[model samples]
Target: MAKANKKDDNVVARNRKANHDFFIEDTIECGLVLKGTEIKSVRAGHINLKDGFARIERGEVWLYNVHISPFKEGNIFNHDPLRPRKLLLKRREINKLEKNVQQAGHTLVPLKVYIKHGVAKVLIGIARGKKQHDKRQAIKEKTMKREAQRAMKI
Candidate 1:
């Protein structure tokens, strides 16, 4: 008998503003240390990544400002919505991220949150803040691209 493979990589939430605000240079997928209720809330799509960022603290990566709403049934055992959560990554990968973040104008921004193979994960980007002019240029390019696609369709 052959084993059937299940579809993986269910995205729970995305930080749509991350790309608009920063130029993403690199991305890494890391696991999140979620409490019981937190994971339930995540599966229910009650998580927000909009204002989330990661910081290396004491040689470990910590995710901050990501909101995981309290579980409906978790009256007394619910975790704090804005609590800092630990991100799981190999030591070498953490070191590499630390080195990259030490460069000027670079920071770690959470791009999205997802559940892969029943485990919660976060996709973080090594990004640099974009200038006002750069943002305008990006918007212009996007509009041009959309117009071109529309012209081709017609």
Candidate 2:
């Protein structure tokens, strides 16, 4: 079977702080458990991934703090904005994430949420917290790179 590419057209929300506050080590894709209007709201690009995180609870992966806006046209079936969504992942992946998270300053953070193949998916990354000096160095390095690119053009 061939897998179809479903690139997102409109981005609902992005966790800009994630890149700045944490050094992302690895990322994994997980399916999201959504309700009626939730899928529609997400497809419309009305969701937020900032301050969202994934954690294993009772042997299951759950996402917390992410917001999916209610459907404009939805009435009684509108999904809650702050509801915790279950993540679909294999047992091995769950164990690996949990183990890695418990080591040092590692954590699981969701980077984005979008619809793919008529289903919702969350992109979660295993990250290590960055120190104050690390963030400053990152900004300096980024600025230097931009300067180099500009100089090369002229």
lDDT of each: 0.95, 0.88
TM-score of 2: 0.90
Scored against the true structure, residue 55 in model 2 reaches a CA lDDT of 87
lDDT by residue (tens digit), candidate 2, 1-154: 9977646553455788999999999999899998888888888888888889988898899999998889999998887799999999999999899888889889999987766666788889999999999999999999999999999999
Report the lDDT tens digits of candidate 1 across residue range 101-152.
Answer: 9999999999988888889999999999999999999999999999999999
Clashes of 1: 0
Best model number under lDDT: 1
TM-score of 1: 0.94
- The collision pairs in model 2 are none
Clashes of each: 0, 0
